[model samples]
Target: MKCLKSLFPTLMICLIVFGCTNEDIDENTVNESSNKNYNSPNYPIKSTTELIVEYQSGFPERKKEDLRKKYNVKRYEKCDCTNSRIEKWEFDPRVDLEGRNELITQEGGIEGTDYQFFYDNENSTPGVSGSTAAGQSDLLISSYIKASNSGVTIAILDTGINLTRLPQSYPFLYGTNSDMTLCEEGEETEVSGWDFVNHDNDVYDDNGHGTVVTSIIIDKLFDEDISDYQILPVKAFNDLGKTTTFTLLCSYLYAVDKPSVSVINMSFGWYGPSGSLFPKFILENPDILHITSSGNDGINNDDNVHYPSSYTSNNILGIGSFSIKKRKEIVEPLPFDSRAMGISLLSPREIIKSTFSNFGVTSVDFLSVGDQVSFYDNNGNHYLVSGTSYAAPLVTAKAAMYYQNGHITPTAITEQLRLNGTLLAYYSLPIYYGDRIIE
Candidate 1:
């Protein structure tokens, strides 16, 4: 189950561990809908009003202040996620955004700014509405499904969770003391999770994506009568499914700080490189298992990189999608003449790659049934949605089951998957170690 190490020679070297600090953040309550206006980037290069800057280790505090003053940084705050290694700089309104981009590019960046980057979530189907109640799929069933005595926690980072719609029968959410309106704040020294999109403790799922994703994990656990696991809900994306790199990093720090959390289910991704310190954060926290979606772009990740999923961290496992129901159309017997037409044929293969799911022998480790999976909205109505987003939680649920069974480390759980997997080919293209249908 060890990943293909040759693909990432650079990451093989140990990374520098950033300095740590306890920085207090001033809570600013903002409307989730207000996030709709932030610059949405399909690629990280797209400009945004917000920028993240990481100062070199042992950099003088006075020099940092001088750089901010020169750039007219309207507001600056240290990221608690990096233990104060990076500062988020918001430019003054008087400075034109284009001018800011020009200055950063032309000057090679401010004196101490070692890295500058932006990040946001990209939905496969952004505004498309799902169909009304289609019956749930039976594709995700696994022998591993069963009740757990140990209370393993999985922090879901996406649009928040809607507790009001969660069924009372499934008492899986962390910190829910039989009160539906409790917001599920963390117990003991833990704060359930944070809502970085809105800058509040209320992690409510107004957009329904998080609710659907959570329901998938719950479904796997509930059907087998498992109820002891805790779900730490971290709202990183807003109602419109947009978020900043600062918020994404903040969510990771929050999840890692909690002692109970062992698994993090990230069902979203974007293409291109991000200059943020996310890879370093994942590298530093090696014990926690990070399950990321390989994305739904239908492109090969080896050619075009995807963040976190393609970061080559041994602890990170990328999950892609395959479908038994979706099929491909093929044309046989090529015609040579101009007036001739080839016979059209439909391939009956059941293990083809989900049309929209991204794949790479190096990046994606496994594939699950992702097409036409059933999920619920904020109002508790059922719908069939298809994406790598839905596919990831199946593996997350399986990982939790393994955790309960004493297969705690990422290496052990990955071995379990390798032993249980069924190798297959997608239209003659062999997938090395995936396409495991949990029957």
Candidate 2:
């Protein structure tokens, strides 16, 4: 998991060489100021109140032209546009249709048959480790919190969640939709969500990475032993566990709009700071809390911090991983070189008894699932899991618990966690020079 850092090529070089220096930048700044009021709307555009409709049966196969005319839909070369067949439709603002899509009967199908409405509901559970003291202790402490997360919403910007695989007894641990049924009268319902990879509403978890992360936070909240927290699963990465900058931005925008969402857990990272899209957004909205991973790549010869985490923002909490004793065995220290100086906390990263860690690592003589191993549930059902991807959720869940109890702010939480982190003499050296061990 070395951080990927490619040197800037010709394009970047040209930008740097002739890019606005202080003298030339003044003219650009003047131009920006002069046009600031022009074309800028006096008020925010009224956002359309739209809902997604998930067809129980996949879209009917028919001539594209005929289908569009009959269903009042439009076919397009791409699905990203407003009039596309799979595009979101805006209904009347005055009407409350439970976010359901109205259906019309066709010559071959029945009319008035209701299909499930798909809203942009961030969904997923957090993966829980059954071993580590922090993991187990947090579970025990959550019981006394008495918070059910009925009103609070937590957004997981990860792979996705497998609703079918979740335990039957703990339905709330799944997401906004509990029974896997359509919108209910009293029960929590899916708010709104999207799949950045497919650009569709189907953000299902093909990769177990997301399922593991989601389980950590959701499981703790809903476990009869702990408090219940609402989950908003926003799938940014695909099966390959990769995503582009644009897609990640879209997911962040969606999280920002979630009315009930108070916290966002981003357990992913990229190298180098390009633009400040995420940081600027968080700065604009100071109330939301963002928790991000400090990255798993052990420190390199150079001591550069990772992006997003490196962004100096009070709203963001960067996290690192540590190893703890589990199952009568002492786990080895994480291979990642730690450089989180200002605000970062280190937690266990060994093969502890987590929902996703089933395979034993021989190198460390530990027995828990690896980043690519599949793990089973308490009942013996199995799924694939791996990575620092899973560790981030454990921290996110604890942060949620702290937030639920009103114990800390986003900035304060990181301060306390880092201040309380067990200091290691091994991390005292300069990561790059690898010589002096400064206290």
Candidate 3:
């Protein structure tokens, strides 16, 4: 060995550095850098990291400090939604029970329409308020191409879907991660999509926003062969109907990689940096089309910048609200343009406009009638709700139907949609998605 080393000194030096690398570890344990012994587990490998909160019973106040101390966390701020007011614009039609003139008790829909299924609860019960969506009427005409609706999945990244709310006929199968499945008591009640807020498998809806949003898709496509379509119910928000972008980000990552999930319906938005990590992920995975609601504040997103919607990613389609028909007494070239860009089927205001919907000339790409939109409620009942949240799923349903019809690529889906739309909100103001997408 000594003679060999002397003969080939440079070669011997290389042997010493490389050959003994793994052998230098503690006898029982292998060194981290050893290629020979190291198992090539796929990684940066994503996994959920939960903050363990432990405290004695009856110690309510101690929960915060205990978690901080245990996790060794520094400068912990509340992980709730930043602007609560902005994110929460969903309004039930029964806000003031007295002014129920817009309300109509129907055994079914209006005489000569196929919209009855869209407004029916589990049993087609009466007492559903508001009116039919003009966007629905517009899509029936404009987007003539009927995509293959088979196997198309849409992830509802909101307050999670209540499986109980769905009727037996609407046999939509939700996703389940056995490892991360959540529960209430001893047993796991509902093992469906992950609850990012509570960190469980019980992705049940508490606030009803998710149910309503999910129903929008069903209402539109139920007439078609929607048997094979999947709905990924991801619960990012909690019972309070509040959640942070971080929570949403976690759910966003989970849904992007799932099989057959090409569409995501995000009905909540606030002023946050969507250009950051979220858009990057969506950009990398261009196959998925993230359709987000252009909030309900009735403000211009060009200046204010509602997040997720305002994000300039082609894959991310931001939708504003508009009614199809003109509201009474309000005459303009841009008729039915709600506060944002509405075409009222019925008016919440002087005529009927989506009273609360954010608009943008540059940021928001498309507009749909969010005013007087009917969706299923949390209690297996149906009601009409008003907001851009309701409007967003209209685009998602179209995107899904488009995907079904062969517009699989995000660019193709968006471009084709834009080309079909007519101009709204002043001749050329609404751009990006051609004139006005849908109607």
**TM-scores for all candidates?**
0.69, 0.49, 0.57
Candidate 3 residue lDDT tens string, 1-439: 0000011111111101111111122212111112211122111111122221112224344543553444344333332212111111112333332222123112122111010001101111123211211112222212221233237888888876555454433446444345542333233243445666665555656656676677778766665455557677788776555654446555776676566788899887655333244555567777888888876656677777777787777678888776444223423333333445332222322211233556555677777757656544444454555567777887888877778888887888886666555433332212322135453
**Candidate 2, residues 139-247: lDDT per residue as tens digits?**
3222223233364567888876554443433434223334333221223223334556655544566554565666666654554244545677777876655564445
Model 2 ranges with Cα > 4 A deviation:
1-151, 173-192, 222-225, 300-302, 325-375, 378-386, 415-439
RMSD (Cα, Å) of candidate 2?
19.4
Please report how far candidate 1 places residue 403 from its true position, in Å. 1.0
Using alpha carbons, what is the TM-score of model 1? 0.69
Q: Considering lDDT, which of the candidate structures 1 and 2 is the better prediction for this target? A: 1
Query: Taking the tens digit of each residue's C-alpha lDDT, what string does model 1 give over 247-325?
Result: 7776777777766788899988877764447887888888889998877667777777777778788888888887663
Better of 1 and 3 by TM-score: 1
Q: Which candidate leads in TM-score?
A: 1
Compute the lDDT of residue 195 as modeled in candidate 2. Answer: 58
Q: List the candidate 1 regions with Cα displacement exceeding 4 Å.
A: 1-41, 48-50, 54-72, 78-85, 92-120, 124-150, 176-191, 326-349, 376-380, 425-427, 430-439
Strongest candidate by lDDT: 1
